[model samples]
Target: MFLILIKLAWRNILRNKRRTIIASIAISIGLAALIFGDAFMIGMMENLIKTATDSFIGDAQIHQQEFRDTREVSMTIQELDEVGANLAKEANVQYFTRRTFAPGMIASSANRSAINLVGVQPSTEKLLSQIDDAIIGGGFFEKANEHDIVIGSKLAEILEVALGDKVVVTVVQAKSGDYFEDWFRVSGIYYFADAAMNSGMAFVRLKKAQQMLAIGPNVHEIAIKFTSTEYGQDKQVPFWKTYSQHGNEALSWTEILPQLPKVFAMSEYSKYIMGIVLFGVVIFGIINTLFMSLYERMFEFGVLRAVGTRSFGMARIVLFEAGALAVVSILLGAILGFVLTTIFANIGIDYTGNEMMGVTVQEFIYPVLTIEQFTVYPLAVFIFTIVAGLYPAWHVAKMSPVDAMRRSF
Candidate 1:
């Protein structure tokens, strides 16, 4: 019985090839828009995460309780070795490194700038952060080489410092109710993660920072990397709980980079808005074509009823036509979307010229190809098409055969 219905539906569709083509094209285009939009958003998010994580914070971090609230050197952790050891034991732990941050003034030949000075141990720093990869000029800081510093590219441009130029770093220390001043030279220049970090950040050796700040063996924070970034949050919870039990505070990258969630949420919202617009246009086209086809087949429907076709059977036939159209359209759309997205993923779409959230951008924008984006959009379109066909299908089912047969189109 089902096979007979399918055969009838197929024959009916073949009877009007032009209408089928039009409906299929509508569905295909709609599905393509949804898939491509989702893929583009996903790719952008991935890029954002990669750029932010590599250049600044790692997957996770451990900081002293006071440091989490106030950005002051007084919150420096004294038991660095113990915390590092505990974090290294976790199965998903990749590597960990310690850092100290202080607000200081940097002076170069061309200009003087106020920047956040990050003190890092040269060897372990690479494990925690990708500062090494972001360097566009000169080498990263070395422990043996004292009085050397790495400044962001924007900072370098502003300071007019080159690869081998000497820059001065001055910081005032408050120890035992007394103030001590210290200074160091710039050794390297680093490119910014974005415009913000570039214009106002600098890196230097931990020993050099210790010597300059006169704060020996004290670290403000420990950054951690995970073997797999996907389960970073899950892994972070237990670690934080364990550390918090011992009176130390651990922070995940999410907490440190508060803007990441907002960015992700905005992407999702934008995708939804785009999806609605695309689906509406596609549905309008498909429904208009289907309505015309149904009107043209009024006499055929009447003849079927006269020949003992039940109302339920007639409704099923109409639904079958809608479903078939949906299936064909979704398949074509999915194929086209996948091909275009794959091509774009390789070639990449550049948004460097466009300003995003008040920052000048760098690098190409690539679309992400996730299973949900490809499959879900087509399924949604199919469901909507099927549902939309119901009202028109019922209208046909209710028509009297005598009246329908007499009506002239």
Candidate 2:
């Protein structure tokens, strides 16, 4: 009986070719919008998160218990190997890098400024941070060692220095509580595209930084990155809880950079608002199409009812028509959306050398579609389509066969 009703609905839709075509086109366009919009938003968020993680804040970081709170040079993580072994044991951990950090004074012949000096292993940092790829002038760590420095473009400008220029770095030694100085030649100039980082942060070899600070083998921090799928999962919390012992503290990106999570939440809220507005438009279009289609079929409905077809059967026919239309339209929309997203995903939208909301894109932004996006868009459209059919079906149910036939003629 259901199959027969579906067959009848199909025949009814075909009978009015122009109306069905127009209605289907409207539905297809709406569905396509939903799919594409979702893909774009999700892709954008993923890109931002990736940039944040890869550029500096990995997925998580490990530091001495009071390190982040105080930013004190004395709060160095002493048990590097033990923490590293624990991190390595975690299946989610993709990579980790050791870092020594200090607040220091960088002075050139022309200018002087206070800056955050980071000590990093060149080999590990190449895999971990975008800083290596971000060098616009001079090569990364080429002929660069403990006595060489990689400074940000803005910092270079402030110091009135260029590549190969000698600069004096001064830092307070953690153990002795006394100031020490070292001279380094600027080996590379990098532009992170972040004003704050570019102006105030510089990089050097970890051993050199430790030696300069007289901290021996102690590192101030360990940055960890997890696999892509593991990012949104609160895998860091579990790892932190398990490993945050023996004066160790694990902090996720959300913890270290609190504002980023808030930005993500705001973007999600915006997407919801956009979705509601877009879907509202779509629902209205579907309702209008369903009403027009039902009015044209009123005579046929009344004839069927007079010939002993149940009132419920009339309503069912309308619903079946809507369902069939939704299935076909959504399929077409999905295909169109997928093709469009895939094309753009490859080409990418370039916002290079520009900062949006203080977060700069490494290169270009790519649109990525997830399985959930595809599923949710079609499901939402299907539900709205069924709801759209309800009003027309209810109108048919209220009408007497005589009245329906009279009105239709």
Candidate 3:
């Protein structure tokens, strides 16, 4: 019986070729808009997250309890190896390394600037951060290399320093001694996502920093990378709990950068608003098309009823027609949207406006395609399209067979 209904519905839709074409186009437009919008939003979010994590924070960080709470270097963890060993046992842990960050002044022959200097173990640093890949010129620090520094692109520009240029760094040591000073030859220049990070950050070998600052092996924090970022809060929370139990504190990327969640939240809310507006516009277009088709077929409906066809039967035919059109249109739209998004994902849209919040983003925007957006969005659109035809079906069912048949143009 259902198969027969579907067949009848298919034939009836074909009988009015123009009307079917218009309805299908309306549904297709709606579905395509939703799919594209979702893809673009998700893609942008992924890019932003990647940039932030790569430039500074890793997926997670471990720190001394007091250093985290007070931002004091004096309370740094001396037990680095013990902490690294414990973290290595975790299934999701990919790379772990210790780092010390200090505020210092850097000067070259032409320019001088205040910057944040980061001390890192070269091999472990490469495993935990994007610094190695981000180096645009020269080369990363080698374990055997001493008194060598890597500066951000902006910093290099400001300092007018090139690869092998000598620069002086002066920092206040933690031991309450007089200021410590050292000269380093620049070996690399890197460009990160944020202009501020590039302009105000420098990297040096951990041993060099330790010797210059008169500090021992104590490190301010331990940065970690995970096998998969998708594990996110679930993996980090348990690890933090375990570490806290052993007298240390653990923090996730989200905690290290508190502003990220707020940014993502705002973007998500904007997406919802855009989705609602698009959904309404599409629904209105579809409903208008369906209603017009119903009115044009009133005479045929009257003839059917006058010949003993039940009102429920008429409603069923209209609904089946709506469902069939929806399915066909949604499938077509989804295929087109997926193809377009995949193409754009590789090409990306570019923007060259003023920097936002210290980050100078590239001009290109990329769309990200996810299985949920491709499959679920089309299904939602199809269901909405079918529902939009309900009122028209109900109106057709309410007309009296005698009045409908007696009507003349």
TM-score of 3: 0.89
Ordered list by TM-score, greatest first: 1, 2, 3
What TM-score would candidate 1 get against the native?
0.91
* Local lDDT at 231 for model 3: 55
TM-score winner? 1
Off by over 4 Å in 3: 66-70, 235-237, 245-247, 262-269, 349-366
Clashing pairs in 1: 149-187, 153-190, 167-186
lDDT of 2 at 239: 80
lDDT (Cα) of model 3: 0.78
TM per candidate? 0.91, 0.90, 0.89
Off by over 4 Å in 1: 174-183, 235-237, 352-363, 407-409
* lDDT to native, each model: 0.75, 0.82, 0.78
What is residue 241's positional error in candidate 1, in angstroms?
Answer: 0.8
Q: Residue-wise lDDT of candidate 2 within 1-409, one digit each (tens)?
A: 9989889878877877787777777777777776777777767767777787889878888899989878888898857788878778888788889998899999999999999999998887888788888898887787746688999999999999999999999998896879988999999999977787898998899999998888888899888888853563475357878667788888887777677678778877887777677767777777787788777777878898888778788788888888887887788888888888888889987876576545776667788888976788789878878887888888777779998788655
Residues 1-409 of candidate 1: C-alpha lDDT, one tens digit per residue: 7888788777777778987887887788878878887888787777666555555678777777767777866667647777767777888788777788888888876789888878888788876666776677767875467767787888888888777787777665536423444445666666754766778888888866766666777777777787876755564356667665444677776667777867788878888888777777777776676678788888989998889989888888888878888888888999989998999999999876454543334557899898897677878988888877787678778878988799643
What is the lDDT, from 0 to 100, of the residue 253 in candidate 3?
73
* Shift of residue 9 alpha carbon in model 3, Å: 2.5
Residue pairs clashing in model 2 are: none
In model 3, the worst 10-residue window by lDDT is 351-360
Better of 1 and 2 by lDDT: 2
